[model samples]
Target chain A: AAGMAAPRRLKPLHHVAVSGGTHGNEMSGVYLVKHWLRDRSFAATPFLSNLRAVEKCVRYVGRDLNRTFTAEFLSSAETEDEPYEVGRAREINQTYGPKGSAQAFDFMFDLHNTTANMGTCLIMDSEESLLPMHMCHYIQTHYTQSSCPIYLYKLPGEESYSIDSVAKTGLALELGPQPQGVLKANLFAEMRALMACALDFIELFNTGTVFPAFKTEAYKITGRVDYPRYPDGEISAMVHPKLQDKDFFPLNPEDPIFQPFSGEEILYEGDSTIYPAFINEAAYYEKKVAFVKMEKRTFSIPGLHTLSLSPSP
Target chain B: MTSCFVIHEAPVRRVAIFGGTHGNELSGVFLVKHWQENGAEIQRTGLEVRPFITNPRAVKKCTRYIDCDLNRVFDTANLGRQTTEDIPYEVRRAQEINHVFGPKDSDDAYDLIFDLHNTTSNMGGTLILENSRNNFTIQMFHYIKNALAPECCPVFLIEHPNLKYATTRSIAKHPVGVEVGPQPQGVVRADILDKMRKIIKHGLDFVHIFNEGKEFPPCTIEVYKIIEKVDYPRNKNGEITAVIHPCLQDQDWQPLNNGDPIFLTMDGETITYEGDSTVYPTFVNEAAYYEKKQAFVKTVKVKLTAKCIRSLLP
Candidate 1:
């Protein structure tokens, strides 16, 4: 069988962390983590990352906390005039990661929500690491009951800036169509179920179960398109209504991408078809990205066996 | 066009200010609550101003409505429908409201009714009038426009001449729907709330001046007359495929010309305006209209001339 042979044995996972409220307005993650905190389970641990932003119910008091985890930001000296997220990022680094260190947590899961109509997206950095890829493969196969699509963002050439990057290996669970301040009950339940599945996979991996090699599909980020803007920098066009909630749908060249206030259609000028993610994400409005362009890729993962008998010191 | 306008000679006596007609619209609901507790701000010498929350259940739940939209349930056909067990809460509420404030186009209706509303669209501060021929509403719109800073008020005429309206304010002799926005459905913006309060204050002040028998000079004002509504692009399954384009999203009250982008399809195609002439679009991307199947309401600019009026007093 193509998916049956085993080759590599990876170390058993020990310290797995789940984070929420990275963007305070994402209510599903925030509420799920809050519920977990109330439950007080030591085995299934989760924490709120941005307390100030969560308290105020705003994205962030200073700058986006999720984007403040880079080495440059973590290494920057403390200053009274610096953004609130900068100091908070350093504190988080000390707790979870000091980055690329052996002391870092074994795995992490960052929770997020978007105003864009992305449904149960599993965002990973890249396909370089084997463990995360295998985990993703497991999740994709096991979480078959719902629309769980995997996405590969922050490709090799791009710098990693997300909170999940602090761990040895991790991914972000981004769910949506939820307005910043509002939480849909369905999404909240879906998030809880997804988190539980991720935890189950960790337990399964740690228990020394052999996993078969399998081919899986993921959308990899290629580029981002910004909204059409005026001379004064005011956005002049909106994401075409047709494209608004069509996340992960293949967008062909010359397809309608934008509609200006003047009522003219702007076609996609790209040569090849591409899928889009984060379409009209409310948070990305300030970032100038209307939507992220993606290309679908299938990766073949090698079979994995846990190295539980020989624990690494 | 210099057409003669016949101004209403009756002095406005009782005025009703309604809020929470759409429960998610927080500006009006909160303002009504504030005024109900503190009456000093809305009080004037001759006018008996009353503040009311039309749909308390919706307001309490922070939803638009329970069974149906309260604002759209006030039509004569719905109002006259006999009470039944299966009747919607809003329909029953509308009947009760009609019994209290209106008989529907009768002489016993309130002299002026100003219904407060908010939109998710970026329509600054708007005065929605059903009848542009009514001089009282037009003059009030003109006064509010001049009293506040420029661009503070824009008159929108729905132009329903059939003597039938399903809106909360339409029951009054002179009705004005005060709609302000860019505020999210469930969220309140301090700027939007302040603008709404100012509009109401000026409206009451105008009524006071009219009751005191002041002569008003003839003036011409710009009115956005709604012609038709545009719906979002939908597939065979009736699922909306596109949304209001970003450039046209908040561009309410702005001119739309032929070949201008109106909708962006999910397939990455731009749907431009194919209209032969330029028209103004209002209520662009209203959140509440999603279920109504309306993307935006198209309008044309027309000059409305109002003649001088003096309130008749003994």
Candidate 2:
């Protein structure tokens, strides 16, 4: 029922939604949004009012809320027996869908956290958007105070079935891993800043001043694994599991998971070191491995909203 | 044996091209080499060509610049005067390259010049023409797009006033720096090289000269957005401690604003903003200037204009 409302009219123009904590365990945005919801003193300011005046605002909880925006999934909600997050995604889409069409919302962001040690990343939908470099610059300047090493991720050719692949303009902010104690509050503030920047871009878009462009060259990756590999034989468990730029294991060369069997020497390949190695012992089979980094190129795409990969040059 | 060739068989017209300023960026290096090896087979009908392989040392080192980004050292007043003997080996090498390519006493050595480079980010696909909205820059963009068939997107032409300070561009009356992306064994380098070669061949066929009246392409200028600045923050033990979030993508991020909580030192005390009333934030790995991981960032936005776009013609 929340999906049927007309789009909210705003003075500036365009609309955007920046949602975090889609993975549940990456609780940075969860707590920040929680704080905003519970604390009146924080939300009563004029800045907070301006943020609320925007077209749409989203605060999500749980994993995979980012994976439910396809037309097929949107059509069969009740009959498909979907989970609450999926249904919530459908509701958001319906309300944000184009004025006459079922597609709702012009821009969307799914915020997340990565391993504590990984670099900050701006993961964008490569197909629909183009200017990742510009976006990276904006993110670095506006969100992280030019202090965090930001990277641009272009989805590999192999793993195009994920949720990020569908949206016209969507970015996943990986605030490095779950924080502990004091670090937790810091992470929340980072998420809050990221959200505020997204809101600013939305406001800029509505003002007709937001011109989006993209670089054609993206970090071309070749492999990704949804499952984790257990140590077999003499090979000790990987003290640090990471993705390789080239080569694959467990069959298909395109297969995501690659592990060195016991007693085998580890070989280092590619220009950079291994990345996105999962540390959580309880990670689901669908959450363990990610795409391996490979060659990338810069290109340009012309459109109303452009996706740019803003990795450090 | 590696030989440098000059093609002046055609009636002399002022056009100079310098490639391989940065040894690591090979698109321009190979493109120039290809033309030299096959000049007779690829020379245009009536244009004079001067090609120089500047910064041979840095090229050997495979660096972005010889000493201090040779591209950044161009000054008309400093012409012919060596800056320093104690500078890095690369910087010294850049001075030599500058002397060889720069105009001696007059500003009429060449009508147009091009300095080529490869960038690490994916932002190098487009041609970067220096600080003017001239016809030469405009036509060069058209020629490049038509000849090279670079990635199938619209070419982005950026103009920075500070670019006038660039050594290669500043030395000549008209100079353009063509960035081809990183050379670190990636597809971007390969594609850009292919495109560069195509443009070189097309230039030979068109017979366009820098000072000659060859029509240039139309280009729009865009500005660069400096998104984030990285600082490495360190703890007392020298281990990386906290990542400060000073800038936010969302507009609601403010200092001590509701959800805003400052990170604490390892001993569990919050680090507050000591400066101005504005929100100060820092990312995770900035350099540790303070004892605690309490660095902050200030975000600013600016727009790029379109009139500065130029072409690498003549």
- Candidate 2 Cα deviation (angstroms), residue B192: 44
* Model 2: CA > 4 A from native: A1-13, A38-63, A77-82, A98-103, A127-134, A141-168, A179-183, A208-218, A225-236, A239-262, A268-291, A301-313, B1-314
- CA lDDT of A69 in candidate 2? 57
Candidate 1, residue A157: lDDT? 68
| Worst 10 contiguous positions by lDDT, candidate 1 chain B | B1-10
Tens-digit lDDT track of model 2 for A210-286? 45443344443434433224343111223223333222111233322333222343333444433332222122223
TM-score of each candidate structure, all chains considered together: 0.56, 0.37
Per-residue C-alpha lDDT of model 2 across residues B124-218, encoded as one tens digit per residue: 34455554354445455555556655443123333444313445555665566665542231111234565555555555444444224332223
Report the lDDT of model 2 for residue B257.
40
